[model samples]
Target chain A: MGNSKLYKGSLNTIILKLLDEEGKMYGYEITQKVKELSKGELNITEGALYPALHKLEAEGLLDVEVAKVDNRLRKYYKLTKQGEKETVNRLAELEDFIRSMQQLVNPDWSIQ
Target chain B: MAISKEEVIYIDNYLKFLGVKYMDIRLEILDHLASEFENIQEPTSLGDFLRTKRSFVKRYENQWQKAKHWAHQRALIKRIIGYFYKPNQLFIPICIGIFFGFNATLLPKSLIAISFCISLIVPQCIHFYIYYKPEGIYKNIQSAKYILSIMALPSIFMYLMGIMAPIIKESPTVFYAYWFFAMVFNIAGLQEVMTLKRQIVKTYSKLISN
Candidate 1:
């Protein structure tokens, strides 16, 4: 798995970005999507994913809908308008951090 | 392979047997379990499969409880504070203040104190009943219980004010201030209950429709 600690701080932004792309997703779907997109390198555990989701919901950054799918109730979360704006800001911040880390780790290398 | 309806019940009962009491939380976990269960190639009894996830039961409960507590507390405070700024909402509390303020001079001290205490007690009882009664929608929902606990703040205020009643009654100014504060507290509590009731109704309707 990818270094969980390294990715921990970016979890919420990852979630927002995914929701922005997919429109709406449930808990398991979010975790599975992360694992698939990262090629099984990052595992978003239940312990970490839920608290972040609940916190975002509380902050009015996300809204929820419940639907019956295949004989069970599933809750799907989507970003609010505020959440959409916040996602752009968080992604920009994450990109900057990644850029800074790349410079520190390999000063001679240039993506450009 | 997708599990049968009976298998779903088995998963639910196993969780309940392990003491996962909240229906809302359990439903979320159930979906996760079922989704993953579909991927297993080998034959496995539902109970045995659930045993592997036993460790998560406590962690999920504790994490959810803490998050729910914080979220509801913040929401309650925001909604209460909101009442003061919106003129339409502000009108109710202002009317409450006016009623208490006008009665302060006319009513006897003991009567006013008793009335205030009852105002706090009645809602405490009603909130408890509506949230926990056997058939209530909130009865098995963990998050609703957390919200109800925060809704109990007014009764706590009542208890403190009751203990200090002798001192407060001695000064009309202090008495009036306490009543003013109590009015806001009581109104906030009522509004929370109403809002919670509406949310619970909407949620259960969705759950039932499914």
Candidate 2:
């Protein structure tokens, strides 16, 4: 697990992967999920989470659904067809990058 | 975790006080805060909670607002495209085709005026008509000044296109092209407003009903 500065670039990929698994999620739920999944190591800040969600929504990769849940409007986001395709691509790309980084950082480990 | 109506209202006001002017963004932020409040030991008093959030929001101020502006712009564009491409509107492009196909050059001043009126003026008049009502359609719609700014775009585009209308001395191609562009701009802008109105009418009512 990397620091937030390192995690910043991969936030979108993490979000998309989460959505792929979870079906639909709202802002706070997403932050909590990320924290829980990372064992409280990766806290998706409120500032970072909503803005990224909004950016994704604008990209047409995500679709928004607003429902009045208990008299409060809760906006849920789900991956569109394009977003679903994007998630697979992003995850593959992330995996490739991780593999490359590991090989670079631990070349001696592999030799042993 | 049952968010009450009062909490919802408080969150809405807090976002506003937090300098969130964009209503669409506010809605998302409101829901977020409410959800977080549900998790905390006590959310009834958010004064202390806000101190921590102040820094989080500060981190996002510039980037979040920039993204929101782009999102709104993209939304307006999507609305315009949606308006221009209803299956029934295939004739619109065909009309543009005829202008070029017929080599229409020596158009009368009245024809230009009529096109300007029908395309640019009428649709905006319709926009204002719906806008002035007590129950305006689109929830995302802002003040008149902002709406005017958005509404001004197609109008300005047409004005620039029309400038070419009088300059053309030889071929009517340029003249007709100007008319075509102007007409499209007005109708497309109008259709965008109309589509928003329709969505609001259809969707907003259902929200309350449900």
Candidate 3:
């Protein structure tokens, strides 16, 4: 349930960051990647993933290529030029968020 | 146990309730879920399979609602921004064009050339601005049509004041050419406005169906 809220806010950034790291990925592959990375903590269901992909494509942030994979047509998404720039910006923001969370959790932690 | 065709129909209807209008995508997703049920070779009963499928469908429906809400909010923000930007985009250029074009006769040759250049540049700018911008195509075009109607007032004033009479008598062909061009621009603007209205209606209908 907590993961769902995080997924809602960070869906675009996560998709963008993944595409930035991997050249292109299919919908199922994306879900699997998120699950694997989060060690089963965050699961991206099909319902949540596809619409976000579509929205990002519409916004000119992502480009899609449909291809036949193992007798199934899969839509693969990759970062557009704008998406790449957006990924960098989103990553910095996420990093800042993580830093802030760390400060809040460990109030006496010293700066490295 | 095998799944019944009625279950597929039920799932489809549920998706329809969730506002998924793309038949192809909906069918594909349904098929995927059905196949996942079919893959279970063990002695699982139909009821258990359906229970699992129902949970999956519920999860999907919730997610779909969230995504739709997000897209709607974003589109709304874009529309608001486009509304404010539309006037500046349309009016500024047209005003510059009229300012320069009206004073062309009084100005020197170089100034006349500059005025004509401004006149040409302004229309082209309006064209590109309306054509390229992702938002407010319909609104901008309607506003342009209104502006064109206002523009006709000047020509009417010229006729009433006999300002165009000397030109009409001195060079009838040149006067006809100017009149023809004005009519064409007015028609073009009106046509653009009509087309945009059609597009807006089509887009809204699609949004509703989806």
What does chain B score (TM) in every candidate? 0.84, 0.63, 0.30
**Which stretches of candidate 3 lie above 4 Å from their native place?**
A1-3, A109-112, B1-24, B27-210
Which one wins on DockQ? 1
Give the Cα error of residue B66 in candidate 2, in Å.
4.9
Who is ahead in DockQ, 1 or 3? 1
**Candidate 1 residues B30-130, lDDT tens each?**
98888778778899877788888888776888877777666766766777788789877888777877778766768887787677677667767777777
Pick out the ten consecutive residues of candidate 3 chain A with the lowest summed lDDT: A66-75
For each candidate, what's the DockQ? 0.65, 0.61, 0.07
Q: What tens-digit string does per-residue lDDT give for candidate 3 at B1-210?
A: 434667666656765665554443454455555545555778765456655655555565444445434443344334434433687445533554465456654777566545444543454445445545576433322222332332332234334325655774577466444543443343344344355446445543332243
Each candidate: fraction of true contacts kept?
0.55, 0.78, 0.07
lDDT of 1: 0.80
Q: Per-residue lDDT tens digits of candidate 2, residues B1-210?
A: 676787677776776788775555566666777778778975357666655676665555466656545554565666546546777767777776675454435557666556545655676676667677677534443322234434565667546644555575455566656556666666666665565556545544544454
> Per-residue lDDT of A49-98 in model 3, one digit per residue for the tens?
77788678657688756454332334568999989998999989977877
* Location of the lowest summed lDDT over 10 successive residues in candidate 3 chain B: B140-149
List residue ranges in candidate 1 displaced over 4 A. Answer: A106-112, B41-45, B132-135, B206-210
- The lDDT of each candidate is 0.80, 0.69, 0.57
- In candidate 2, stretches whose alpha carbon ends up further than 4 angstroms from where it belongs are A108-112, B1-5, B13-26, B41-44, B54-90, B99-110, B113-118, B132-134, B137-153, B159-171, B206-210
